[model samples]
Target chain A: MLKNITLGQYFPGNSLIHRIDARFKLILTALFIAMVFCAKTPAGYGLIAAFLIFVVADSRIPPRLILKSLRSILIFIVFTAVLNVFFTKGETVLFSWRFLTVSREGIVFAVSMVLRIVFLIVGTSMLTYTTSPILLTDAIEALFSPLKKLRFPVHELAMMMSIALRFIPTLIEETDKIMSAQKSRGADFESGNLFRRVKSFIPLLIPLFVSAFRRADELATAMESRCYRGGDGRTRYRVMRSAARDWVALGAAAALTAGVVVLRIFGL
Target chain B: MEILRAEHITHIYSPKTPFEQKALDDVSFSVSPGELVGVIGHTGSGKSTLISHFNGLLRPTSGKVFVEGEDIWAQPKQIRRFRFRVGLVFQFPEYQLFEETVEKDIAFGPKNMGLSAEETAERVREAARSVGLDESLLEKSPFELSGGQKRRVAIAGVIAMRPRLLVLDEPAAGLDPRGRDEIFDTVRAYLASGENAAVVVSHSMDDVARTASRIVVLDRGRVALEGSPAEVFSHRDVIESTGLRLPFVTRVMHRLRDRGFAADVSVRDLDEAADALLRLKGGGGRA
Candidate 1:
């Protein structure tokens, strides 16, 4: 059952998006997130939507995959929408009930909040879908290289994040194995009261935590045996370089920001 | 009566996705009561997947699993009951040990069956004894036990339920020879109780040949071979084609026969081969 999780999962593709430099894609993703939040007017949202659609189409990633990632945080999205719909007070009321109010402004606010969240998630997912975890971490370490002057452990932090991301699937698969093991022993994780169900998870959680620590210890030993002593003096085999396509991607991000800024300034 | 049967089982993993692959295809088998069936296959040959179907842990894309003549998936809700009837000890089952104490871990299954505390404790002690775990060690935490002890505890947890059909997926995997022998002995004794059957999934042909009465060979999700151990070992070429080999003794017997020595080539283990060779020697080396 845990296999359905698609969070941070990378899809292999040979499209322009996949070929673009990881550093450029990362920067554009952050810029896209900012532009989505800055979109307050219908024209701004329409522009962002168009750009996202164009990116999705060009990337060639299956739309179903993008939608699957959204499934994980769907509850959060619905909650935010409902909160905005029922609680945001406005001068123009659409419907009123005892202690519950739905206003025209509330409807717009709810729709915008949901749209912003959806766009933010899809935009970030596009970045991960196109870039492999190793490349993504390399790009992050390179982006943070400037902070080395501040005496920060930028490389170490990036290594840690990458390791964590790399093990997400492994840990998930382990969890599934442990769950099935416990299930075969007559541990019922489903069809129980809330309390009983929570109690049943003890069999699964303890073993998962134990195995995770064991894995971490093994990984540490394996690394140490290979003479890994932090990122100092470590040279990468693959160097990140900006290609012509990367420059075009940067320009596209700039154009998106400009569009959002123009729509805000014109009050469209 | 047949304790378990899988009919034309076909399991396609992540169907309709890029990861789509057939883990099992058109496989059928049955385990009768008191039979020890050893399932041997190369990695990813669907041995684990087929065993998972016996207890309804996995649903086949197109097939049916029957436990005690009733379709496990017919009701769906009562599939949990089949779990108690068909206990599956996963690969490296030591990782499944979770209860605070060894005693409690072994009792977990019976408790889940809603047995009274007295009955659960009795079953726990019996299960521990069956696995050769000392009564003195039951009070200690499972974490305090050695690796072999921990695995036995996990096995005892399932055995306490007294499942009519026990399915073990590489129970002796990642263990020393002594540890593997201990586990194999315990499982053999457990099946000797006359009320239960067993299906052991193993890559170790020697271990399976020594323990199981029947051997089922899976090659790429299909039943490549199935028969008594002697019968299956007789066809060493077919078994080896699936990236598996007959037990060492069986191979020795085959070589002896090929060398024109009057020897029975159907020996399953070292003891049987030794007896057959001694008999041939006593008979003046003639068949």
Candidate 2:
């Protein structure tokens, strides 16, 4: 059951989108999110929706999956939209009930807020879906490269982050095996009252922690054996460079931003 | 007389997902009381899935597990008790050790059974002695133990529950030849007691041949062969089809028989093979 939980997991592929620089996709996703928020009119929102659909279709990733990842947070989205629709002080009262009044401006604000959240998640997911996690970490290090000038310990921070991300799947696999082992020994994790439920976690947690530390020790020894000194003078195997397609893609994004601005200014 | 019965059990992992696997498909088998059955299969042949269903660790997709003629799933609330009745020591169970001391760790299963402290302690000692763990070592942390010792402690943890039906999945995995012998000896001792039955799931044909009275071969979650060790070993063609080989001792006897020597191909254990050879030649020469 735990193994099936693949929310936001990267799928390996060799499409053009997957081949693009991870750094480029990260920046583009950020720009796309900003553009979605800047849009207000119906046509602008429609374009943002179309852009998300286009990206998903182009990447050959099913849109339903991107939506499926949002399943757990559906309540949060609904809560936010409902809170905005009712609490925001607006002028145009479209309808009035006993204790609830629906305002046109409030509805618009709610719709835009919901759209902003939807686009934010979908747009960010593109960076993850198209790029492998290792490439994504490398891009993050490159993005934070300037922080090294201020002696921000960028190497160590990024290394930790990358290790953490790398171990998520491995730890998940370990947890599955441990859970099964515990269950076989009659570690009753599924039943009982509140106290019993909490008590049930002892078997799972202790062994998991033990193996996690053991794995960490082994990994550190392996790294040391490989002579893995930190990023003092590391040279790159794959250097990031701006390509023709990359430049064209960035320029197209800038043009789209300008178009959205023009449309907003003209109230289209 | 069926102690544990799995009726037409089918199981699928990650159902409907891209990574979905039909682990077991309509597999059915039963073990009678006082029987030591060896379950043999490849790594992903659904052997683990089949064992897990015996105690309701996993419910089959379309079948039933009846322990003593009562469906294990009939009263889901009593599943924990069912677990005590049919103890499952998972593959490489050393990964599940948690308590501060070896004694406490070994007592985990019986403690879960809600046994009194004195009773749990006695069971723990019995289990520890059965697995050859010394009294002094029982006070040490499991983390302070060697790999084989920790694995033995883990096995003891399950054994302390004094289950009527004990199931061990690859209990000898990661152990050296000596450690493997110790585990097989302990299992044989448990069976020799006559009140307890066991199911040993293993990939090593030698281990199964030495310890099990009856043998069961699983391929893709279905029972490919089921009978006494001699009966099952006779189906060499079907066993090879599942990508399993006969034990070296069995093969040696088969080769001898094929060479027109007066030898019995029905022997499963090395001792029996040696005895049969000695009967034919009247000497204990290492052939």
Candidate 3:
């Protein structure tokens, strides 16, 4: 079947990082990504790596599983690396073959770019790994509560977002099952031409969409029966709160960002 | 005559991951030819997992599955042939129906079996007739049909393949009593000829008693018991302790036997029980 599926890959644990507010995490991840671009040297990238390792360790998810997530993106890393390696111009060339020249700077540039991507995926994965989608949506809604003042349907938007997020795994599982079912019925997907491949997706996608909407209908009915009145004064099962640990984590992120900025200033 | 046999099969989901679960732990069973076997288990007892292995849809984590004494996984790429040999009607298979017309949907399986278009059409009609679907409905889109009709259409799709073995996961689930009876009626006729065998994975003891020649009870992914309906149903105390109820007629008959009456322990049908009661009443002059 369709392995390598990481949708809503929540890692349940009683760790400090897992207990942190997901909204803060989402924001901090954005800030951390922005800071990755600010790093100008190997030492600065080292800081980012250290920070990622610290966060990952604090989340308490086994390294083996996180490495499994990284495996799928290996091809993307190589693709990005090759693009950067071939595109970067430098006066110093390490090797030249035909029209292709491998530069010392280009190799370093590719390695750094690939490292950035690896960190980017792993860092974002932390949010999903620690927080379930429902709790994450509630935190997002609560964090963006001020948007309600601007006539934005914060609750409705969060509800829609949560529903969409929730269905990612469900739809993936459904697509996998339908694909296998069709495969058993001799709907060839692998040994087909480009046109045939696209055509093959018709059977999979149509059934997937049909089942998804069907599930949505059933879920809405279930929710209505349970009296799921939207975010209008409706309390959550688990309230979003920022505890002392959240401040500590945020403080560490701020410090890391400041250190990176200083390093960029020095170009060291 | 044993068409399907899973020897020492074990399956684990999300293995080595934090959420790892042993769905089927060393479960083994064999289905003899023309035998209607009922598989019953509590939720998460690996009943669904077990049926998936019958048709090579799933491979065991360890151990072997043989279809008619041939290793289904001998050539990994040839697993599709095994699927055609064993038709599996997955739970809620109706949701998998995507063809524009009922005829096309029913033809899907037979066509997948590499049958000629004419042969596929013939099977489509035959299967539809077997399930009591009208020929006029063949032109209608499967989605437009009622839920039970769509269910039968999905079932007909699999049956049209004419697999040597048929495995259905809860065929009569969510159906009205009449709809349930109609399904079992078709299954009974299909099994009457003893040309093929079918396995029904269900939790309803009464339904199993009414339809299956034998029952295979599963507890925690192990085959707790596998025997003819009468032999398995005789262990009412063990069945009850596993959170499974005995067949309705069997419970009634058991109570009568407790009262020093020679009520037949094999009576699982209402009519049969009624007939037995009448005979007992006449012999005892209680009429």
Error of 1 at A9 (Å): 1.9
Instruction: Give the number of the best model, judged by lDDT.
Output: 1
Instruction: Give per-model TM-scores.
Output: 0.90, 0.92, 0.90
**Global fold similarity of model 3 (TM-score):** 0.90
Q: For residues A112-151, could you state the per-residue lDDT of candidate 1 as single tens digits?
A: 9999999998998899888999899999899999999999
Candidate 2: give the clashing pairs: none
Q: Where is model 1 more than 4 Å wrong at Cα?
A: A37-44, A71-114, A263-268, B252-264, B274-287
lDDT score for residue A192 of model 3: 62
Off by over 4 Å in 3: A82-87, A91-108, A183-186, A222-230, B253-265, B275-287
lDDT of candidate 3 at residue B71, scale 0 to 100: 95
Residue A12's lDDT within candidate 1 is 86
Worst 10 residues of 1 chain B by lDDT: B278-287
Candidate 3 backbone clash number: 0
User: With candidate 1 superimposed using the best TM-score fit, by how many Å does residue B108's alpha carbon deviate from the native?
Assistant: 0.8
